[model samples]
Target: MKFDSVIMGGGLAGLVAGISLQQAGKSTAIVSMGQNSLHFFSGSFESMTEPPQRVADLFKDAGIGLHYRQGVRLMPLGTFRESAMSLEDIELFPSEKFARRVLIVNFQGYHDFFSSFLAEGLEKKGMRCRIRLINIPDIDPTHQGPGEMRSVQIARTMDRIWEKVVQEIRLLLKDEDAVILPQVFGLQDISVPGRIRQALPAKVVFVGTMPPSVPGVRTQMLLKKRYQLLGGTYLMGDEAIKAHVHEGVVHSVVTRNLDSHYLEASNFILATGGLFSKGLVSNPFQLYEPVFGLDVEFAEDRNTWYNPAFKEDQPYMGYGVKADDTLHAIIDGKPLENLYAIGSILGATHPELGSGAGLAINSALVAVDQILSEK
Candidate 1:
């Protein structure tokens, strides 16, 4: 198969890149190895603690509509910590107005979320909050423990009995200003929250937790749908295993599935993500970019890779392929003529901030702009 542009990795960056190029009348293809970290998405996009003015414009041009908010919001997870959440599918009440009565809804047998913990944190923050645990027998028939059940399972089961759940919530939320729920809405049900809000008297907000992220999956699906609508080809459940390079230029890439197939492209964008996604690998002493053997920037001594304090920022988080201002991957101190890198793959930021999605989206836009300008 051949395309004008081929994107590696189907994460936020790769999908955005595909959409941008396809909308520009370029024939694009996205080679993905199944789902990316959107399964663990934190329900928001973070560009920085304070994103720039251009970030909004960039998102608009990329056809990604996100609810832009400033500053950080406390994610309702273990210990209730502060994280950046720029975009939200549901309506998020401002922190100041959140002093009203709040009801946190949790599903029975779904151990990924702890409503009590979030309620306590909100109470400590001076918000009048309480917990309401709804026992949805259909969601977990066997009463599986936390380790046994996945977030996706609960979300799917919830979809099967959504009307009942909504009716129960309507009764439980009397006089409450807002309803906070675990990210357990259906996988593709982006309209469910809005529908619930319209049916209920209070506002609705979905908080993110660990893996099998509902919001993350929604975002990924939204991006993929938009990309396909713009005539981008998506090769799902396939991986780009090798690149046919000639004199530092990647002429084509080989993907693996049932059979080995090649995709030829004039331009390539690598957004396979960092060590977590296996885009960059590391040993005791050296870091390696597995696919193309691209140059990686890391501390020589492994001891400097991590801080003595576990909670402190680690050096390894900032390690990734170095890129030029045009978003081209830099190898041997020179930029690859036809290859560009974006998202977590080209890094100098802390992963703890959960800002990779925003960075990925913005970098994808920049990379596409450069690609089109050069054409």
Candidate 2:
């Protein structure tokens, strides 16, 4: 089946692209493989207003323009905001006051408040809150029940632990939730799965990271049910293979679910995320571009990308793929048109001040408007 736009990767960025396109009356499909990164998130998206000192220096060194601020208010992708967003297609922005001020829940480390408590807060504020989580294991990965941590061992051993985290974050971003705050180290940008062409006419498949999450299993189930009701398409289970790109245009995506399956689409969005999301990086040696042979602009040295010690908790870890102000994919001093990249894939700035996702949305809003205007 042909789609007006084919989105590769189904993490938060991909989901937003799909939903926005569908709402725009465009035939859109999401090609995904393996687990999504939204599952293990805190469901609070932050548009970093402040960088952690050293990170600010790195952005300065990189010559990137970023502003540190309090949490900006969030609106849908089409709504107008004072500083952050414009009256563009699907205008949206994340709120800093809402994201940072709220009580957070960390299952692995233990914070405070679960879904029920947050629900109560939303009620008290008279603002509806969306409760969605995705860092949970599925029947295919777990044979044991929820109580057994061993049941999640498959995910832990298979690099699925982070995928679960991203899936939850993705859902929160898409569902108009409070905000998505994932504890995962970073994001990944994998290829679009080959499952978009396989979706049944009346069915919606969710291509997200699967594997059980800590105390988030119930939420994942509910999200799956609701996504189908919304007519989504997904390609979960296993990693996505390389994408089919010609002259800077992605035509099809191949995945690793059953040896190999090919899926095709028209226009595509690369939302596999950054190095951590596996949407852009391929190897630990710091190779980039997991799908379609897209060029990834990374630091000159891997050590420059991260602090020598993991304990440093440096925000410089957020880096990959450089683009110009137009948000076009750039490589070898040329911009690739018909190809718009967003989210963690951008190398212009780090998450130090926490504007990584916010900048992504801003860039996406910019790109979407350009696309719509051209239409």
Task: Give the winner by lDDT.
Answer: 1
Error of 2 at 204 (Å): 36
Candidate 2 Cα RMSD after full superposition onto the native fold (Å) = 15.5
Badly placed stretches (over 4 Å) of model 1 are 48-65, 78-85, 90-93, 143-149, 258-260, 349-355
In order, what lDDT does every prediction score?
Answer: 0.76, 0.45
Clashing pairs in 1: 39-213
Total clashing residue pairs per candidate?
A: 1, 78
Alpha-carbon error at 243 in model 1, in Å?
A: 1.7
1-375 per-residue lDDT for model 2 (tens digits): 456766666655565555555545666656666455445432223453343453344323322224543233222221213443211111123432332222222233212214445445444545454544443444222443334333133323323344454444444453342342221211211111112112211111121122333212322333333333346565555455766666766666666763545666655666677666776754557656656555566566656766778768554445666555655666556666666676767644533313544554455555555566664
User: How close to the true structure is residue 270 of candidate 2, measured as C-alpha lDDT?
Assistant: 69
Among all windows of 10 consecutive residues in model 1, the one with the lowest summed lDDT is 78-87
Task: Report the lDDT tens digits of candidate 1 across residue range 233-321.
Answer: 99998888888888888898988872556888889999899888888899987998888888899989998988989988777888988
